[model samples]
Target: MSEGTGAVTNAGEGEEVLQPFSVTIGATVPTGFEHTAAEEVKEKIGAEASISKDRGRIYFEITTDNLPKVHHLKSVDNLFVVVKCYDNYQFKDTKEDALLDLQEIAPVLPWSNALEVWKLNNSVKKKRSRRRGAAPKPKPSGDDSEGEKLQAETSMSEETEEQGEVCPEQDMSLQREQNSETIENKPLKFRVTCNRAGDKHSFTSNDAARDFGGAVQEFFQWKADMTKFDVEVLLNIHNNEVVIGIALTEESLHRRNITHFGPTTLRSTLAYGMLRLSKPQISDVIVDPMCGTGAIPLEGVIEWSHSFFLSGDNHDMAVSRTVNNINHIVKRRQTGGSTSPGLPIDTVQWDLCHLPMRTSSVDIITTDMPFGKRMGSKKKNWDLYPSCLREMARVCRPSTGRAVLLTQDKKCFQKALLRMSGLWRKTHTVWVNVGGLHAGVFVLLRTGAIFGSTPENKRESQKASETQVEDMMENI
Candidate 1:
């Protein structure tokens, strides 16, 4: 045992050993992202350390060949051992010394390092044998080997046949069928996530627990609620699942894939940011008047299981692309029997500045306002904000429906809010890292009541009927 380095050592007790020590590595700030990064670090450390999440943090266990160095390293609180294992028959004094050394670093670790030292010794013995004797084992001969190979082939063929029959189109039907059943029977939680660095994917719910396996299982078990059980954890699998975590759907990560696409609002942020809204108990009707790439509204519908996934945008190309994408997703889900959820977006060719829907008809108005940096020109953005927001406010039921919007230009948006006569009130702001742009996601509530010239014009029109009042109003 070593005091400063938190290293566990094996003195010349005739054989080498491997040690298992649990560690917690500290994270650099812009907080709430340490958990995901820590898990990634654990994997990078190779077979020695494994991380399982617990209580919103990760539980890291490392197996080391050099116990003394690890013990010495323990003095650094950034990474310290919480548990240690050793063989019982040997190294009693060494274990005690190691414990004392590790305690000086982090006193909270449970379990003695001596009880399981035998296993480490065994592993060392096996490694030594493999190194010392380089000769490979001879292959099995004749019918015995042939029989085993044939059996393996048969099993593989059956699996391939089953998989070959399955396609993306049947995926949605399968999800709908599974929705009717309870969540307890599932094998692993399916999570979807966008591959954004520094985004928070640490929340644990009952759904996360049943769906995720490996390190995620440990984390979710400790932090999540278990009463409401539904297990599905979707993660962005790009970059070798480096950005792997929970997502609402696969579409949540689609925005990042658009190259030379420039700046854009992510669907994950828009969906998760809208939890503050007050709404009816209705099962569906989530609308995005400006559903560019079908990000916001798709997030809303998939996350909440809202039935009517209605979306509209002024740009024909964007609308067409969105339609094709959504249609592809829908068609795949219909034929593939997938358990994954679908947003089932219905795209319409319309302008956000003049919405086609009736007043007070929407349950949610979640959108990403186009800005000069992304798709629209600066002058166009200036013209678009107020008119579009006014229309969004007009169609939404005040006090009941809420709008979640993301914008890089907060000052201009605020001016629009004020000019529209309080159609929207700023509620909350989530600073998100969408690609490289650090932007604010705003949640606003519609005031519902008519504002600006609409109410004033009505009052003037009524005033014209009264003799004395009309004369005074007209003159003024």
Candidate 2:
């Protein structure tokens, strides 16, 4: 989200001392992708970074002099620098006692004009958006429905009521939460997520949480902005403990600067995670046959300097988008950026079922295949999967080469896998939560040869495979 790409910034600084500080930063990722995100954190941010994950989120504790490097980490959604972790956050505790607790934490934290505060412990889980042309899905609603609206009114009403308190520094951002159906239907301009967990002794009611939020605004001198906010703060409360930190970037890190995108452009973070799991090495010829807008190859070139990329898609529009995005990357590189030369790269527009490649020519492959309700046809995939897998097997190097494919059509994909059990071996399968869909990421190793595998031979096998697929789909 921030402009820089995780490089050392401001070496001669005030807070960064000779002895690097022990800092805790939060990294968020799509569900079940924490392992890969944690790897990115260690590789990009700190060599000795201690990482932990909860609810698909990562918390990294590292002793580092360079904080900007952490800011530039890919495969992460949001980044937070922890200011404090408290043992107790009882807003309903005695007024004097609550004030005292907030006082101790206030001075150490660097306050912003506008703050987006959230609870990590008892936070609400957001509902995912529905695929296009599918049913009109509901928005992600959290349990703290009224809590948000209450927090907003209380902040504005209370602040305005205490009309005469004169303060020298006024960096308050006025952010109010609206709970109306009209506002809810529209995309959220800004959001403050509250996570409440561990020990019910603190919040006697939802107002208790609202009051605490007001206390935070008052202590930090932050103004609530219903329209917008400059910073996001995560409050993690575990039992009697609470940890607070401000986001390192204004927007989520997953939102890259790529100017062009396809209808199904893969998430940059997911693309990075897939590459990491692909076990790419020097001289590895990696590929993404379904490469939409070049996220996979673009991320690959940036992270793996030794590898070359072959990105292709069946759609002409996808190819155009990828080319445009590559040009932008090149422009950025000229003005001094971290991405490797976008050289040793090639693009193609062809049918996935009939790829033009030599047997055992490619070293590795990774692609985000079509999924979702309307995005892909389960019936068509029955024919497409086997054909595409055969072509992919023909291209990848035998015995040692690998691929990481993501798709939500588990039944169809598994049917294809079962039919071609000898050609590819499934090494790992991880179910990742993407836009509310449980996408299975398959890591397959090229085990059998496919130089002259005839497509005609599959007609007989198709009849049997379809029967098994139907049964599997029923159980699913």
Candidate 3:
């Protein structure tokens, strides 16, 4: 295939060259949202993604012209360009034999295209970094400064020790020869990161990385630098499957949105997944009653600019943090030459159980509730969930309105939903991983039953009167 329009040119040839080819791109997403991420890839990049269930990964093929679009995907946490994939790789019986096989395969894989893509991605990332006002680090000079010399020495020592079977004398001699030969022409620095999952594996991830890395160094004559590497190679092995790739993202993209963080900040990637589940439409009034830093509403306003978002929390700190995060985005937009630097979002401080919004006003409600671990207690949630859910039903438009609520207190939430069955109907549920805690995202639709006419409303009114009578008797 001929390279597309944005194909990389050979550095020696000072002209643009068209070489058409397709490469597989791998992305890591929130574990339970693999389908959500794959759907996003299909919608935005026009690529049909293959989802690896329960692994939080998806793969799709795209031409070089679409590389920049891959970086802009909101559902992916990290991106990598695949060099090669083996669906059913055979492992040798012994650890040494398996690791040796990995080392032997490094030189024969298709590295040219992936490396070219990596080079092209550097320009894209640099442009983004500059826009974010992040200054780039100066390239290390070839001159043997004391720090460089020490780092090189330390790296050699560590590699030798990690291999355990390497002859220190031979390694030092080889290093000296390699250093002398590349003194004039500096080689790219690199590191190998291996992630292996499977109980049947004979080798640890470190063993595979070290042996494979040594072979890569020998084949390319590249220097091994762990911290300041120019390139990162990934070795992902799961069961009989193996995928070798070049890392395209230096850091996880989930940090792209938030500036000011609260005690329990939800990941932006996960937030996007939750928002996608809501299926937002034009002019939808979305509300997050317990917005804690306003992550949900902020993500909603950015992705679905047609929707208006209202974020509120009872805590003073949370309200302040939400406002700060919104202002940061406004400033960024203003700097980017936006004629109107305002987002369709607003923040307030209010109790979740006593929202100030009028009944039947909101179209959608999405919020990440306190998991009772970091933010609130389990005892409090027992009381909090049912009360807030009632209030949510009051504001949500009947039949057409929906809410996506995430919480680790599933038992409490389920019980609360049972009490509000007259007002809310659970339509779907997605189990997700949040900060190592197992949580559920419940998708509930508002029942056609009017606000105060529900059986739940009558029960709440009776309970409130009973409590008021008890207080009055104590005063008398």
Q: How high is each candidate's TM-score?
A: 0.44, 0.68, 0.85
User: Can you give the lDDT of residue 37 in candidate 1?
Assistant: 34
Cα error, candidate 1, residue 281 (Å): 4.9
> Which 10 consecutive positions of candidate 3 have the poorest summed lDDT?
144-153
lDDT of 2 by residue, 161-261 (tens): 00000001111111121324222253323222334454554343233335555555665455555336433444555456566665554434443634575
Task: Report clash pairs, candidate 3.
Answer: 2-19, 2-20, 3-19, 3-20
Q: Pick the candidate with the highest lDDT.
A: 3
Of 1 and 2, the candidate ranking higher by TM-score:
2
Ranking by lDDT: 3, 2, 1
* lDDT for each candidate structure: 0.41, 0.59, 0.77
Per-residue accuracy of model 3 over 323-356 as CA lDDT, tens digit each? 9888978987888688978999999999787788
Question: Best by TM-score, which number?
Answer: 3
Which stretches of candidate 1 lie above 4 Å from their native place? 1-281, 338-344, 451-476
- What tens-digit string does per-residue lDDT give for candidate 1 at 1-476? 21122243564764333234433221111112233334344444432332322111232334433322221221011122222222121211343442233223222323233212222322333343444444332221111100000000110012100000000111111121222122233333322111112223332222122233323345333223222212322221111112122211111122221211212434332233332232324464677776655645544454456457688878776676566656655544555465763554578989675678887888677666665665677677765687677667767877666777766667778777776655677776656444344556677776656533476434433443364466678899
